[model samples]
Target: MILLFAGCPQSSDKISKPGSTQSGTTIHGEKIDISETELLTALNLTRGSQSASEAAKKIAAQTGKNVGRLSFTEAKSLAYDDEAGTFKVKVVGKKNGKNFDKTFNVTGFTHPYASPPQSAIQVEFKFDAGIEENLSIDKYIEKITPNLKAHLTFSFSLQNGKAITLGYDNDYYELTAQVSNSNGELKISPEYKLKYKKKLRGEDETSVSTAYTSAMPVFTGQKKDYFTEKDVFEHIFNKVKDDPELIVADAGSYASSKYAFAMVLNNGGTLFNTGKIAQYVNVYNTKGADNHREIKNITPAMDNVRGGGITADDYEGKLTVNFYISKAEYIADGNTPDDKEKSGSYTVVRSGFKKLPSDISSNVRSVLEFSLGKITDGNGTQDTWKKRRINNTALISMKYTGINSTYDNWFSLNDDLKITGDTSGFYLILNGQDYTSRMPNHQDNFLVPTNGDENVKILIKHLQISKNVGEEELTIRVQFMGGNDTETVKIKPQSY
Candidate 1:
């Protein structure tokens, strides 16, 4: 399941500003400047077991109690009356020998006078009973259902051990919650000691990390379901544009499940050469001295395997790419060719996107040019060429089509061309001698196909590394000794 977070506010309103007393006369020459913001900040200083009202009370007691404050006193006492669902704070003081008073009322504020305390975080959950079609968020509820549930005992902690716990409960679920600072950031865990067992069966007990913290009051949904491509783009591209090496590797449930909701990174497109991540890991560049005797002079290589760079660039009217894919399944046609090593074929079926012209034969350059315009970073010369890699698993399949079909004599494997290696930055030595004998059953081959009988020579091969390093794709013009039969193909890497 893919979890995504949207519309989460980063900060709070009602900013605070501190200053000295204005308008009111000062008593004993002590200054007193108070705004709603300043009062909240000052009230936050009290130690454990102190409520806002209790803290306010402490402030009220100390007004003229010790600090040479303009004489002050609590004109009214706080009370927990069921009729009024809010806290009332009233303090009267003398400033500059003048009389003045301030009153404050807040609905969510704690009434220290009460026996039990409360917190600010309000956790809500939305569920779906049916399946979604587009797989976006169809069958899901916009906001949590009618259950105005609250956890009774909630606690959380950080990787470093610092944490906070609070008890909360309403009608449906009773929970003990804890939040801790995991390294510099906060981690929240809410465990429910749920009362109604059978009714909320699936809700028995689930420990999902809350995105809220002391520093940042916003609680992103549960960690597992909170990330999107926009989040990644904002954090990685916009946030760390200056640092090439800087990376935010999220190894949590939230980081991993984003693939489902991620539309920013298109998995299939023309720029992508290989199909899926597995396809790249399974590539095998078969080349060199394993069988054929007459075939010699082959150069092969594989580069940038693991953590290899994945790139999308415009090439000759196409969004050419160095993509990852599964291994190619090879099969040889059993046609009897004296020197053709049983003309074989290979199929590589990887799940990926392909960028092709509306008409394959149309000017490919036009498509490439258009793509470049869309991706080019402001400075112009190819800044949109970002590097990315995938380790996630994806499905892929391959099947070779031309196994044993006999081609018109001239198209025989003796001269039919096959080339491999180092295309994907991997290398394989390619240098072989062209030979032909005319004793009884001899055929002539062309450097560039002089005629139908004069077959154009081509090479087909794969390469393997000692410990399965990796592979890359290279673009080089391939042709016969003196002919023009050129096509671009990938030089994929393999593990074996």
Candidate 2:
């Protein structure tokens, strides 16, 4: 059965600000002695045994009357009142140096990798804080007003982590944040950057380091930062010249998800190519009009622009993406490829937004399941549950359409149920040797086609168990999201 799995609080909002960690005691300011951890605990009392109230009490007690200007507040679970389908985050703070408490409602999602698999991964909603989706950053903020102000929406993304890896050096991870007003207009996006570097120690040892201001470009102040292609679609639509502009809007257009851009650009009556599309992007390549933030090849990136640099957030956009389905799912014979089920143009960012094929569900909840029987040791020992070279009791039949996999999604039971040192997404195979997308969960699209004579399949492969505080006969439930309907399947692993 699916239950609340909270061991070590398997999730974190992780909203860090422009501050120093050189602790003498506070975070944003002194006298404000609270870490992000304390802040989250105080904000979300549902996780612990504490609650602070406001009426005549300035700061209600959590432990031995340990209260400050800000206090441990209240929270409402999903089983209570909420329209946006999110939990309530109430905080008591000073509005203008006075007693103020407001419950902030939030719509957030737990990345499957971030939480225990037995729990409802969609406990809240939305996807991970990846570069792939345009997720609502203010999931925990947007609703707060009065005494408390300031909300920060942040995304942590590692797009092509090792951009220029000369024997593992110069790795960059992007942190995007936006400040929203009441009208949701007149906002600013400050790109926080984290750079990773490794120093080789002899032949077998190496150390790594990072800094947010490590290699930041001096492109702020009066120096005008430009907008990316995605910034045009999301923010400045009027400046968009042609359909090609919108086609190249997503971050992945230039490098990774190029197929969708190439296809859509050509169909829009422009003989599209990299050089041809870069011409349209050139419109924004100037001081006043450019994609400085999203400009990959630029030497030093614009970490924090004063204002206006809406360059391509090109992580994910569905200007248009077509799908190719099997004959059995299509139901009808088509004269051309475009006449198939998902053959038409689609503005698909999050599935079923504009259009989607009925058979080609974006996320197939368990259309299938397996009796993920017991997992044993390498020596096939049922005596004790321990890690061995190979396990005797592993659910070899964790098959979803029987993933005809050539993939060895191996992981150490050490980190986040990681697949080959990475704990994010599985491979999405498409034409021309894996149109491999670093798909953020519930954000990017997944298409399945038989590889030559290989059968179309998606297998669970393996389930990584870390600790011992577990449940029995874990029924894995998959929620298949369609254009209009939602289908759910719970797979109860049986003994093979």
Candidate 3:
């Protein structure tokens, strides 16, 4: 339930060559190994009569081909039938099926696109609602790649400055609740296909020295899936549900638990609502047999990213990107931290981010104008906003109009398709209040118009400022989508 997170913050330090090994945090100065990923997860089931380990066993038993069994075979689905004594194939939409690994692969593009709109993966798919044509990441693929979308940390950049995004599946796993498990149990590992096959050089099976050869596109993980909301509690279970009793968590007492994830809990959480049970997808403590507790009959972890050789955890920041100069630490297997059975490599990736310009030129400035400051937080807020018919509700707003120009411009068009919940087109900091996450005007995608638009000799729209913000000075940082450039607009009452 407690995940130990470790990583080096994003730095300009040079990284060692791939094929590294280490344990805990001690890198042994070597090539990056892909076997260190040992996914950690726990299963909690409510049955006052049963012990915690027993609850874990029952979930695993029912997950296998038959109920009351602990061996995983090729036919275990998230759904199962415990015939009072025996468990068997689960019926999904009337047909018995094991969750097959879905594949999504990206190549031909590099990280740090040479320009905006072009993805770092070079592959871009757009949404076509009528046909659901395996659409762009804007569609389903952006979701279920095992919970949270992959951050830029899992990517590596080549000399060409193009990055190969390996993604979150290359590092972490989410404890997802199964559709039927209210208090039953949720699979920690998501079912979207993100599993990869390791291309072992030979059949040694003992030595990982010749495990991989980067001859031609060694990444075997093919992309093809959707995004699913994940619980921060999954990443930190014990903290959220420290009590041994599942009913307590169900009674909503977990909400007041001092260590619960504030972000999720504060917004009215979706966890432990009717009580809870955690069904860890990767319960590797198979004290009886081999790969028995693995979810979906997958070997080791629920998928490769969780078990095979990758390891990652919540960095606990609004956003914290960490990279390691490819290294590996020695972990002594299940019994001791002395053997080298499993190892995964994480190395410092080449940063392809371009440095922002030191100054915004007048031409860029000419494109938009901030309205004269007539800030008001009067009680007639509803009437004022209603007059404008703005979609975003806010305490106060200022006009940021466009100037006549033929060039393409945007307010906060978030072009990065890889990350979710991060489409802040623009940010407003009134005094010291951070209003990046609550921008009503341009929540995610709002395109700017050029001179060609009939009404726009120049048309200004209001930028919503959140309630409770101080009126010291309004600072706006707009990320113009034209070329992924940022422009600052600072306004003071007297100055404006």
**lDDT of each model, Cα atoms only?**
0.26, 0.25, 0.24
Model 3 agreement with the true structure over 273-373: per-residue lDDT tens digits: 22322323223212222221211211111112112122111111011111111001211121212212222222211112222223433333444343222
When sorted by lDDT, best at the front, the candidate numbers are: 1, 2, 3
**Top candidate by lDDT:** 1
Model 1 over residues 1-496: C-alpha lDDT tens digits? 9998898645212111222222322345444444544444544532223433344345555454323434555434232211122333455665455555555543333222222122323332221211111112211221211221231223333332333334443322233444333442224454433122111111222222222223223222223232222222122222222322221222211111111111112222222212222111222122223211111211111112111122221111111112222112211121122212111211122222222223422332221111101111222121111211223211111113332322112122231111221112222222212211210111211112111122322111111112112323222222211123332333322211
Candidate 2 per-residue lDDT over residues 371-459, each given as its tens digit: 22332222222222122112122222122332222212221111221223211121112222322221111111121222232233221
lDDT of 3 at 1: 94
How many backbone clashes are present in model 1? 80
| TM-score list, all predictions | 0.20, 0.19, 0.15
RMSD of each: 27.1, 33.2, 35.1
Q: Rank the candidates by TM-score, best first.
A: 1, 2, 3
Q: 83, model 1: CA deviation in Å?
A: 13
